[model samples]
Target: MNTKIYCLEQCFLPKNWELLLSAVKNVAGFCKESGKYDIPTLPVKLGHSLSKCAKVLRTKAIMEDNEDVKKSVEGFLKLYEDEWNERISVKARQTLYDAKFN
Candidate 1:
């Protein structure tokens, strides 16, 4: 994710469409790696920050009139949605425990 975010930052340079595309690819790669880890929980703050980053990139792509960047942003958004859905909350854990115990 850090790598993805770094790539995203590089995408901000004016007329650097390649960098923007790379950033979007990196985000997808990071998401795939995260799934392999099967992380049970994610910090809410981190999630929010990532979400914000995606939103910013999306808007930037649109503003720049880059269709390829926009497509990449859509890919990143899909990855974000999948990753967030997999995240477990404390309440969810408690519910699982109760189900198992009862």
Candidate 2:
């Protein structure tokens, strides 16, 4: 995967699992590459950024081709579904409460 995948001005968290899986694959592939710095920081940086901005995300993206990068993305997907659901749940509750009381 090209490192330019991370050049987006906004987060890419598609609602569809397949697209999201493709993205996670890209990130995992990118993470496997050797960074110029002493430490491999892209994973953490990208993870934090996506987590911070993806709460209200609902968009689409073109899926990338399948690559050898698999294990980490699969692991993340297992946990990601739950985490994404929790964020959406919190947002929905807040919206409903605000609509009722505000």
Candidate 3:
């Protein structure tokens, strides 16, 4: 079995199972290498820059035939961005105290 496939299956929370899959569908290439891209893994800071950087990195990784987990994070970021934009009717930064997760 593929390592990425296995990890994608084993990892993620039970409550977020569906959301995670939805996230993975949006981000096809996700692996540790792309996860190392200069962004903080912490939740807050990661959420802030994740959507943009993850999209670019994941797209590149897919082109290179490599999987990058950061891409998955990017998918989640986009979901939140879309939801927020829908609710507030504004494209703006909503979070504060930028930090991260590891």
- The C-alpha RMSD in Å for every predicted model, in order, reads 9.0, 14.6, 12.9
lDDT string for model 2 (20-80, tens) is 4345445444322431122224334545556544432222111333322233344344546
Candidate 1, residue 50: how far the Cα is off, in Å: 0.9
Per-prediction backbone clash count: 0, 0, 12
Q: Give stretches of model 3 more than 4 Å off.
A: 1-48, 67-74, 86-102
Q: What is the lDDT of candidate 2?
A: 0.39
Report the lDDT tens digits of candidate 1 across residue range 25-59: 34333334333222223233445565688678879
What value does the lDDT take at residue 80 in candidate 3?
A: 54
Clash tally for model 3: 12
Candidate ordering by lDDT (highest first): 1, 3, 2
Best by TM-score: 1
List where candidate 2 sits over 4 angstroms from the true fold: 1-68
Estimated TM-score per prediction? 0.45, 0.28, 0.27
